[model samples]
Structure formats: C-alpha cells, structure tokens
Target: MAVSRPTILIPSFNTGPLLLETVEAALATGYPVRVVIDGSTDGSETLLEDLTATDNQLRVHILPQNQGKGAAVLFGLEKSLEDGFTHALAMDADGQHPADSVTAFLELSSRHPEAAIFGRPVFDDSAPALRVNGRKISNFWANLETLGWGIDDSLFGMRLYPIRKLIETLEETRFARRFDFDPEVAVRLAWKGVPIVNLPTPVRYIDPEDGGVSQFRYLRDNTLLTWMHFRLMIGFLIRSPWLGMRGENPLLHLSPPAR
Candidate 1:
C-alpha cells in the first residue's frame, strides 16, 4: 500500500467571510487544503482566489451551481484522489467545525489508515437545543441500521474518511448527495465493515452577527432524514445477518502499532 497522504477538504456554500477563516485554519495545520465552492452566489470563492494564488497549500474548485454538500464533497474526493491523497479530513466551512482539531484527526487517520475517524461533537451553549436534540432521531436509526457499529454521532460533519472506501460507499447510492449525506454515508460505511473510531471534538455555533451562516431548514432536513432512515431500515433488515457474522474488518483484527 502507498504511504497515507491526507488532505483537508472543506465544502462551502455561501459561507461568506467564514470561508476564508475556515480555509486559513485548515492550512495552518500544514496539510494541503482543498475547498469546493458549491455554487455559492455570495462571491465567497473569490475571497480565496488571491490567497490561493500565493499559498501553494491552498486550492479552490468552484461549481457552476449549487449541487448540495455531498455532491461538493464527492467532487473534492475525485480531485483529491487524482492528487494521490489517500485520505481526506472533511469539515464544514460555516465556522461550526473546529479547524484546530485537524492535526489530531489526521494523526489518528495516519495511525489507522483503514479506519474512519469520526468527530463526536462536544457542543457548547452556542449549539441550538432543537438541532442537537433533533439529531438524536437520526443517530438512533443509524446505530440500529449498522447493528450498533459504534457511530457516536451520525450527523456530525467533521470526520476523516479513507478516500477510496468512501468513494466506493458513495457510489452504491445516489441519494446521499444532499442534506442526508453525513448520516447516510456513516451508516453505509459501517455496513461495509469499515472500522470506526470516534474522538471528542469541540463544536461551536457562531452567531449571524459574527458572520455565521446555516443552510439547515429544520422541517425539510428532518423530513429528508426521516425518508433516509426509512430506506436504511429496509437495508438493515437485509444486511443484519451478514453484518452480525462479519464482526469486524480483518485489517482491524490486529492492534495499531503505537506511534
């Protein structure tokens, strides 16, 4: 196997000034950073043009129109793969994800290259109660679908994925291309027998006054999740037997060597 080469991938959509901040922080981790502008009409991609020119560590890819978060990420993954990146640490550009944790997650990925490193969000008061509580519904179904494969938080977007395995998982379904991306991918990857590792990471919700923008529509997203889980339940019923006997990935049978 080739040596693990990881890149920080941020998918942004109309995140305004926060986009620059997120990109800068990711670059600060000394990793190659790629940002996919998901058809943002706010002139946000232009904000990084000058910086991207001067900094070899940063690159920006713009889409003609908004295709949703998952589509944006899939674009990044395809490019990253061509760039020879073995893994990708994906985080949000809306200032909710902690960029400082980039090194930790990447380090964990380096140690366990075949496993998925997920961020188990530690939310502060800045996080909205309704949103936090609402995610529980999705999490419950995700765990059940995977036969309790240890998905600490299904909706958290700050996670590191092996580029190849993730692409394969995404190719298996076309519906994870929008708001349903995060949770659906997690559950499906678990079903594929990818080992999961979760680490506690702080998540902060920025206020609008501070240039924080949220694309979440409570009713619409929740409905999407409901439909997503309904489909996953049917899949689970079909896969549970195989998943139970599978136990774990053979790559995970041995302990990771200490760093």
Candidate 2:
C-alpha cells in the first residue's frame, strides 16, 4: 500500500546548536518537516528561518512565548493537518532521538496507518541512571491506567502520531500541554482504542560539550507527571465500563477525523 510521507514535527525551546543538527538529520529522510519554535530565546529562530528560506520542504512556526512541549507539538500537528498531512513523526530538538530510525518508523506507520508508532528507546551508557529509573515509575502508572494496553515507553518523545486521532485525543483535555505530553497522550490514545506499535530505536544522551542541551527539570517535570497520572487515574476509573466494552472491539471507540 502506498502511504503518504509524514511531516516531521519537532518542538524546540532554547536548544542551541543541537536543534540545527536535529533538523538537518530529519530533513535527510526526504520527508516534509515542520518545526514549532516554542518561544526560543537562544537565537535558534534566526537559524531556523534561514534554513526554511533555503528549503521548501522545511517550514517553521514560532510561538510568541514559551508555552510547553505539548502546546508546540499541537501547533505543528494542527498546521500539518491543515496542509493535508495525515501523520506526523515527533522527535525532540535535543538530538537524543535517533535520526537513523526515521525511515523505519515512517515505514511502519505507513503500513499500519491506523496505529501510533512509538519508539521503544534502547538507551546507551550515556543515559543517566536517575532519569532511566525514574521513567520506570511513570511507565508503571501508565500501564495501570491503560490496563496493560502495551505502551513500551511512556516518556520517550520519539513517535509517529496519526494526526487526526492525536488531535482528537488531545482536545479532550488541556492538561497534556507540558512535560506530561508523552505519557498522557499515550494513555489517552489507548483509552480511545488506538492500536500501539512499539519499535526499538537506540537513544543517546549527548554531553553538553557536544552541543547537547537538556530542558528537563527533574523536580518540576516529575511533579507535573505525578499530577498528570493522578488525573488520568480518575479518568480511567470513570471510563472503565466503556473501556471494558471497547476491549472486545479495539476499533470501537476511535474518534472521527477532525473536520
């Protein structure tokens, strides 16, 4: 089956030189790429603007101020949908996500157009133990919320989202606008009965000296995730009967495409 090429949607905030490298790598896949600059004050806007001027396949959108990762991603997804794209592959701007796996992920999404393709990170030694272990806690809660619907890694930011379903899922609540994006979206999509496809991809934590910039605030983001999961638990319980019935037919509750 012939599938449309997905737009590469990247949400960036103050990620310095790494954003440039990430964009270049994404463009290498020969797919249309759209980037949302989340009020970056780090001079990345000028750099991206220049690139957009040169490449017709690359488009950049700027937010007036820093909203959050999910907000920026929503902006890009909305714009891509308006432009007639059906799917978007979202990756971070900090260069941790493997660019080499872009083709494989896109291919899988093309084959399984109704499913969300999530990257199951194979972290190298460069990954910090603290962050790695902390994700386990989030993953556990995510599984419980979805009743073991098979989301491999809830916090990994690299994934291919079916634009219509993702936008529909996100519109149900405004809580997924920040660091809670990855996990919240996964659980919500699962609740909507979207099939999950986990693909193994290598992840590397680049050092600062290598132009890697990390915006993860250990205390702040984790606290945000804690609240997010708390709210999801309530939602899960409220939807338990609906969820149980939908289990008999996984495609029973999918939202209609956005108009």
Candidate 3:
C-alpha cells in the first residue's frame, strides 16, 4: 500500500512578499497544500486568491478579523480534519524556517504518524543573540512542566501536526493563542501521550533592511507564556501520573551541568 500523503497548512498574517516562497517550497515537495489568511488587510489575500485560482492543489481559507496565529492554526486544523486530511505541516510565512526541512518533516510525519514532528532549528549567525538565549529559559520551564518530557525547543514554528489529535486538544483547552501558542501546544501535546520527534533544520533571521518585520514582544509575550505554563501546570497536576511514568530522560533527571 502507498504511504498516506499529508497536507501542509501555512498561516499567513501580513505576509505577502514572502508568502509565495513558503508556498513554492511546500509545493516543491509534491504534498497537498493550503493557506489560511488570518485577516490580513495587505493586498496579500488577492495573492492567495490568485495562487489558489491556478493551482488545483492549492486552497486558501480566510478569516474576517486578525485573530492571532494560534487562532488561524486552530481554524486550519478544524478544516483539515473536516476535509479528511490526516496530517498538516504548519509553517510561518516569514521565511524564517527552511523549506528543505519542511519536506523532511513531512517525511518524518509519515513514519511516525502518531507523533508530532518538530523542527529543532540549526540557527545561523543572523539569529538574534538575545532570542537565542531567551529560549533556554523557556526550555527549562517546559522541561519542568513535563517533568522532563524531552522537548528540545518549544518555540520552533515549523512542525508537523496530526489533525485529529490537535483538534481534540484545541477543543479541550483554550490557552493556546498569540506567542504563547507554540510552547503551550508543544508541551501539552507531549503531556497527552503524543510522542514528539525532533529534526534539526536551519533557521534564518533576516535583517529588516531585507524586508523583515518581526512581531515578537519580549515582555508581553513572556508574561503570556508564564500564565500559559501556570495553566499547564494545573493540568499537569491532574495528569501527573501519566507525565511521570511517560518516560525518563537522563538529562532531565541528572543535575544541572557544572557552571
């Protein structure tokens, strides 16, 4: 029997110029693809309309107002489940993630159909020094939240999602939206007995001179993440045994490396 091919879903928000690069890279892999426009006023929707018009494999979904990326993803997940697609690989329109890695993630998803595949980024010098360091704090908190659930990096935007389980997760919890979305999703999915597989891929942070615009807010989003983990901790308490007995990571169980 042929391996089941999964669909790829890209959430575009104010992402017009770089949107097609992401789409083209996705199509280059020969997988079914779709884009969800989360209320972008930028003439980008017209681009989406045009793209979908020509490519029978490309479909676009739109929302009226700018709900956050989490909301757009939730919208896409629902539609993916409704459309009968088993898997959806999510990528950002901002060209931060590598296209070649996306094809690899989809292939991994095919092998471990029950697990979510996360892109563990291989960052270049263009990556922000501060953001790079800040991830350690999030990584620490995620490990604590899962009793060391083996989350390599929680903020990577590129990941392959299993639609049915993700939809079930979205319905069960209301915390994943905005910047807190990625970490919350990755951690919680790990808690719910969903295996996570990491694939190393290059991530580029383009200079603003190169038409790059980032929407990350450090203080505000970090506070949101704090609250998200607070909520996840409460759920973790209820699901304590499951997380505790899930597995053992010697790195997590071992003491911090000598400073």
The most accurate candidate by lDDT is 1
lDDT digits (tens) for residues 55-97 of candidate 1 = 9988799999999999999999999999999999999999889
Ranking by TM-score: 1, 2, 3
For model 2, give the 10-residue run with minimal summed lDDT: 250-259
Ranking by lDDT: 1, 2, 3
TM-score of candidate 1 to 2 decimals: 0.95
In model 2, residue pairs whose N, Cα or C atoms come closer than 3 Å (at least 3 residues apart or on different chains), thus clashing, are none
Write model 2 residue lDDT over 70-154, tens digit each, in one string: 9999999999999989999999999999789999888878777888988888888999999888899999999888887777789
TM-score (C-alpha, index-matched) for candidate 3? 0.91
Model 2 scores a C-alpha lDDT of: 0.87
- The local distance difference test score of model 3 is 0.79
RMSD of each: 3.3, 5.0, 3.6
TM-score of each: 0.95, 0.93, 0.91
Identify the runs in model 2 with alpha carbons over 4 angstroms from their true place. 1-5, 248-259
Predicted candidate 3 versus true structure: per-residue lDDT over 42-147, tens digit per residue = 8677755666877888888989998998989999888877877888888888889777776778776777788787777788899999999888888887877888
Model 3, poorest ten-residue lDDT window? 250-259
Q: What are the Cα lDDT values of the candidates?
A: 0.89, 0.87, 0.79
